[model samples]
Target: MDVYAANMDRCPVYASFFGAMGCACAIVFTVMGASYGTAKSSGAIFSSGIIRPDRLMQNTLCAIMAQILSIYGLVTSVIISGNLVEKMALHTAFLQLGAGLAVGLCGLAAGFSIGVVGDAGVRASTQQPRLYIGMVLILIFAEVLGLYGVIVSILMLTRSTLGVTDCPY
Candidate 1:
């Protein structure tokens, strides 16, 4: 019985540690994705001979929005995981972590799509309808990632409920 109790104690600790690591991974991936998207978008604008001061400001604004969204996801994940682990169950922690990743990925996709579409739209406003269509499609596709994250979170929460232990706090 002592050995079994020791093992149970270790499980929660491991779960918490992994949950934190997962949150960190999500944050890193989100930031990298945002940076890549920003660079690609800005480079496109510059290459198109439209890198005027006004366009620079617009690009900067879009990048800032992306950063904000990514940071929000990171912070939210940390808080939610902590709360779920402390007040709910170990599995809840994993669910929160997964949800955070989903949200971060969605934000990354949105940032990239927005940057690309905005730059392309500005550059080819006078010459193309296809670009606009592509932008809409990308936005829709990016939103799908967020939806999947929500679904995963829901499943996690449901599973946690089925196997709940007494709350630590």
Candidate 2:
């Protein structure tokens, strides 16, 4: 018999609550970031479009890149949801929470960075086409920040277990 079996009180429905919160965090924070990025970049796109209509497509890439941040959150949330179990362990719940936070916070940061850079980059590049390459490079670097979060979250979630530790059922 496992020592944890004796402490059944330690295992409670709150475990599922934590896991659910994780899912919510993953979705909410990321979407917020993506939305912010999109709004900022879209404004820049319209402003820049007035100057150089021909470069509209190129500037649109900024908004598209911003949107990708939300996808990262979506993926993390789905994975965390899948890991949730009827009789979840506290360890697993914490793991899920960590995974969600890792992705959520990182994605938020990335999205903000992308939005600021995209807004400025798009506007500037419209005047000096030579700056387009630099803007793209910066965007790639900002995008990598979210990717790092996804990788970390995946690693954390992978360690979670769905085993029943002290559930009555």
Candidate 3:
């Protein structure tokens, strides 16, 4: 009877895990669509000169940064969800939260840097080839945040204690 009760308790937890996975998948697709739309719109505006070249570049950079962050968030969320389901342990939740926070902070910094440096690039691109080089540098730096987040998430997943035997189902 005790074993049966434990099994019954695990059922709802597993159900919630599956539900969260579905939600994460939805978020991933939504971000992809939004990123594509933003890119298309930015290109159209730039080609038509609807906005100043500098502003267009800045906007596009911001959109790209957003897309990168969203992709990282989606991947990390899926990984964390799998780890949580496997472990059924509380510490996994904290690790997931920490990773999420790291991604969010990185996104914020990237957005700000894009706004500032992107504007400058628009002004300098006409006279200097180095402007493009600087843009590349900024992009590389922005991407580092995503790398750190992934590393932290992997570390957490590796530390999870739950094994096949602990699974109630």
Candidate 4:
């Protein structure tokens, strides 16, 4: 059989699935972050006795950031999936995998930070509302962490190359 020889010109349809998996990974990672943020922030909000229940929305800022992180992941996932070609190159597949990890891990880190800070910040704010601004600043910084990942992934996707650098001379 002649099927064992090297063939750089061929890309099987199954290769496309690598890109699909990347898209799925983005969604999964963001969802995990959102869940953690919501659960942690909700617990904090309830535990902190509220002198003014009307401002409960203020305490949910952390959860909101987490949700926004998920949105970022969603947008990236859409972009990757939309560009899915029938025969995905090996280089593109690796790039897709990197993109997914970039957003996923970053979102996870940002969400963890938000949950931790939100729990304490919300509690602190309930007692002394003057700390609201500082809490917001901290959350923004955490949000930026996830944004950095998104930016890097976008750059990687845009700068990817054709998969053919290993041909023997």
Candidate 5:
């Protein structure tokens, strides 16, 4: 038998465990990032809103942006989880893990950047409304980082066959 089969015989559950870990990582990390971003920016937004109540709605965009990070993770997790099975291939498991990491880490990073920038931007925009445009541009760039991760994870997942047959490569 092949080396993978031999290993699977020794530890049948490991492959599925890896896939489950991937799903967990994708959801956990992204949620953590979203939470951090929301907490960081919400305080600033509320404080600034008290000064200019009319700007409250606009400032809320920061929290909304932070929440998007969690959505990225949720999407990635759902995709990865779809491939999980009781007897996944080791290679497939690793691929699933990689896919999760790609999106999770990127979303985390984007969330952090969004939080810091959102907090500062909201505060600054309260002083000079023109800064709002610049902040949005920067936020968009930060959000793109998470988008890149999702693209890469999707590409990786496309290669996973779930042990139906050997990998093409």
Candidate 6:
């Protein structure tokens, strides 16, 4: 005889709260990161543009790269939010949280990397146009970090439908 209430197929209202917060976190943190990256890298644009105005468009790559991070977060948040149902399980909520956090934090990291590297790359390119290729490579690497997060979050989102009894372990 079980003394405590069996969680079985129970679907509590509180269970959905976590998923809701997760969705909010994904977009909020992503926007914050994109803002930071753009602001930090914009300085390089202003400084470098004065010397080599022709490369201003190329120098803007860093901020553009950083902004992609937020888009990833938005994608995942939408996926998670769409999955949210009236009878959400705890595990589903946790899954959303994990997905949201992964994308959001990764965005922050990508933003930081783009900001610093972009600033330096933009400045350097002003003096040496040949450095543009190297800057592209470095920015690509930084941008991929966010890609990894998006991919993982997408994979994690698949588990949202599982119920308590669905765990194999």
lDDT of each: 0.55, 0.87, 0.51, 0.78, 0.84, 0.83
Q: Over 4 Å off in model 4, which ranges?
A: 1-13, 161-169
Model 1 vs. true fold: TM: 0.60
TM-scores of the candidates in the order shown: 0.60, 0.92, 0.55, 0.85, 0.90, 0.89
Candidate 4 has what TM-score?
0.85
- Candidate 3 wrong stretches, greater than 4 Å: 1-66, 84-87, 162-169
For model 6, the run of ten residues with the poorest summed lDDT: 1-10
**In terms of TM-score, which candidate is strongest?**
2
On lDDT, the stronger of 2 and 5 is 2
lDDT agreement of model 1 with the native: 0.55
Off by over 4 Å in 5: 1-12, 162-169
Q: Give per-residue CA lDDT, model 3, range 57-91, as digits (tens).
A: 44365356546656666776676566555434334
Q: Against the hidden true structure, what lDDT does model 6 obtain?
A: 0.83
The digit string of per-residue lDDT tens for model 4 on 1-169 reads 3432343443454656877888888778877887787778778887774666866877877778879989878987988888787755667766787887888788888888888888888889888999989999998998898899899888877865543343231
Minimum summed lDDT over a 10-residue window in model 1 is located at 53-62
Residue-level lDDT of model 5, residues 70-127, one tens digit each, is 9888998998888887866777888889888888898889889889998999999998
Error of 2 at 76 (Å): 0.9
lDDT of 4 at 3: 37
Against the true structure, candidate 5 reaches a TM-score of 0.90
10 residues in a row with least lDDT, candidate 2: 160-169
Between which residue pairs do clashes occur in model 6?
none
Q: Comparing 4 and 5 by TM-score, which wins?
A: 5
Once fitted onto the true fold, the runs of candidate 6 whose alpha carbons sit more than 4 angstroms away are: 1-4, 8-10, 163-169
Q: For model 1, name the residue pairs that clash.
A: none
